[model samples]
Target: MGLSLSRMMAVLTKEFTQLVRDRLTYAMIIGIPIVQLLLFGYAINTDPKHLPTAVLVQDQGQFSRSILGSLQNSEYFRIVHVARSPAEMDKLIERGAVQFAITIPGDFTRRVVRRDKPQILVEADASDPAATGSAVAALSSLPIEGLKHDLKGPLASAAPGPQPFEVVIQRRYNPENITSYNIVPGLVATILTMTLVMMTSLAMTRETERGTMETLLSTPLRPIEVMVGKLTPFVVVGIIQAALIISMARILFGVPMAGGWAALILGLFLFIVGSLALGFLVSTVARNQLQAMQMSFFYFLPSILLSGFLFPFRGMPEWAQWLGTILPVTHMLRVVRGAMLKGVGLAEAAPSLGALALFVVIVAGLAVKQYRTTLD
Candidate 1:
């Protein structure tokens, strides 16, 4: 029981030899961080370009024509559809086909001629607040000179142009158009998906790689209990991370939590469960921790890129937007951002919550089934 320096030295020397013999540790220390840096650099673009748009020209007058022409001329809008009616335009916007829609009323030109306010309705999907800023700015500024020209045409004798009706501008979601207000909501989901999935999967992979999983299975401990225990810590960690991010957003980034805190937390719980379950599936199939990490990153890439986290959901190519629907992170992000920035209730967040619930049920069932069969 007395101090034994020789024995301690021998144990230290043996551990060092084992560590040096295993090349995997050194590769891990050098390789993984490098790959993360490269991926982040390429994929994390904030200033999205070439956003698609749809035009709803209910009015065929000169004022409507000029406004539509401005949008068409801009590099931001691709103008995929020139909708004949409001109903046609609404369908495209809801299903995610278009990033913007300019609705020209029947009185657009007449109002300007009659010296009344000329109205142009621009419905911008402010889901990705950062990218939508440029579009909103351009659209708001569109009717300015055109309306002035129309107003001046009627008043030839007057020295200056009459004041055309004030364009009552309404920017959806963030009326102030704050980027952090929108970005922070989505950040919670992105951070949770990466951390929750990677953390749980790494531990599961660690058990199998280190050969402790076999010993646990041989004992009386049930698979469900082991899994529940494994997940409990991560659930706590995920929630804590969510709180930290939300607080940082408020203090550092000026993001407001406009929605009910309870709703955000509940939705986040479902999101975390779904994400961790997906990681469990990855862990079940992967042969080692490295492979698990690689597989997790594959999932992460599509989720972040196509989930409307890094890119505007409305702005992506049609095929990419369709692919985004397959991931639960995309739906949950809508719920979180909707609640936080839009001040939406459970009614508005219901669809996203339902999607997360379905994804969780499916992934959790598959993971548990695969784990059981693998043990047998």
Candidate 2:
């Protein structure tokens, strides 16, 4: 009675058998740790390199060429676009097309020879400060390294005293580099993603567990009708959550609402629908509430990490970036940040909007198909 080894073994064996039977939970237990290890070890990067840059070199001189070459050799800046004018370069930065823009005035060479200390303008899209920090630091040594070969015995005097040219960095779209400015907008996407998906999945799974789903499914309602009916309330909750977050972002964090409200509203609607649809899909896959929650967490992990919410999106490896791109949260973050910080309009936010719209369609379709299968 005091110590029964046989009884203990029987209970332990039963639990083990149950654990093995629940494949989803088993996978979560084993798979979560390995995924975390791989992502933290290989996918995440703090000091990102090869950032996309645009160049507008008005000066065709030797010194200009030297500076450009130095930038490329630094391995920090990858010159992806050659802009013809200032307007074009600005457009590139605004669209998030380029992280950095280098503009060397036409008189760059003549002024260096005259010791006029010509200024080279470096404009950066500073929305996510962490992404640009290392690259900006690398620019400080460029003046000396860029002009070293061109500055010979005759020009050694000009190079020895101070830098021949000044590198002036213009940090756009969060000039002060406020962390909250970046974090707040991203929170809009993150919060909705976590709550709406988790809630919807749990709600649907609850219906099944309580045996209410059987009664509901017996009705004349179509699969799409059921999905839409279940998801509509959550959509309203998501909207309210978004509004509260945006208001707090403006009032508490002092984040700018620089872009048009139309774009923000459009993005929010698309993202909310997409997130709810994804939740519906998760619910369809899960056999119970616990499994629904586990699946939700699995989805949440990648959405938060790879979506550039916690880290710089471009800072991740190419493969990680590709994975991030598939998540609806990635595009939602872009749309939210673009509208709040960068003043992007519908045209500029088109790509992200389109991506969200597509995600909604695909996920919703899968959810309906899964529900229909259950009906059979």
Candidate 3:
């Protein structure tokens, strides 16, 4: 057919009329860029500061107290817990409750007074090397800087020699400081989230758009069944994405599967289900495909921000951390990282798994309830 200017104008006019009728689409067109601006401008900060730290102070010495003060003043470490024993400190790090654990020796005061090198141990959860790298680097000069006041006069002169105290950093899990070791596992959660949520979130909206939702509702199948059926295909999709990401992580990024296959697989399964359930819940509320897409992006911003994928989970404020706890992404990140890097078993990742199970139950229950039976 020959190109016609009139025909093109007619089609353009039709599209503009349709665009005006779909107010939600217009709102998304205008609002998405503004939201992205705010999200990227205000919410995202990769150089996270004031990471949560724990203290195991075996010495009540002035020098020990000064070191703690310096850590706080550096704005890099926030002492959230004061563990009484090494065992307690281990539990904190293992659970990811604290990013760094500072342990002062009992003889630290005496050794510093005698001009001998006293060692203070700083054990870090190095699973996310970016989270710990800056903090660890800051510790190098802290001992000398902190003791400047106590090292007045004679001790000041001794400053010319080796520092009286040493800050020993024990970077656990990822001692080699591999960035991919942290990023690859997080990619499992990130990929699953983007795919599973976005996929299922459009289920009802797409059906509604195609004018098939009422037909599906007319069937004997319950709302829950329809939701589940629509979600199952996306579950498989999530698994495929996981497999590809995991394979690339191992082959290209040199990421290791430190834990058993079964444990990682189980965690992935639970997390995938939870994400699909969340998407189903979103679909229940969205009136159309555009609204659904917009809502999915709205949920996505927080998932990436508070879920510990881009920044240290503990680095955020207490309220933000608590908010993140409700997100399956946060727990999934912990599970995947622990299993892959820390070589943790299922039991070790039980807390995260349990959280994921709770999220699935709540989200699935809400979705089942939210799905309209009569399509009003």
Which of candidates 1 and 3 is the stronger one according to lDDT?
3
In model 1, the worst 10-residue window by lDDT is 153-162
| Model 3, C-alpha of 145: deviation from truth (Å) | 1.2
Which sections of candidate 2 miss by over 4 Å?
none
Please give, for residues 72-137, the per-residue lDDT of candidate 2 as tens digits: 999999999999999999888988989999999999889988888899999999999999999999
Q: Would you list the C-alpha lDDT of every candidate in the order shown?
A: 0.73, 0.92, 0.83
Q: Can you write out model 1's per-residue Cα lDDT over 218-327, one digit (the tens) per residue?
A: 98776567677778778888889988988898899877677656557778899888888888888898878987887787778778877877666655555666778888
Clashing pairs in 3: none
Error (Å) of candidate 3 at residue 21 is 4.3
Error of 3 at 22 (Å): 2.4
Number of clashing residue pairs in every model?
1, 1, 0
Q: Candidate 2 — worst ten consecutive residues by lDDT sum?
A: 154-163
lDDT for model 2: 0.92
Clashing pairs in 2: 259-343
Cα lDDT tens digits, model 3, 216-304, are 87888887888779888878888899989988988998888786566678889998898898888887778877788888887787888
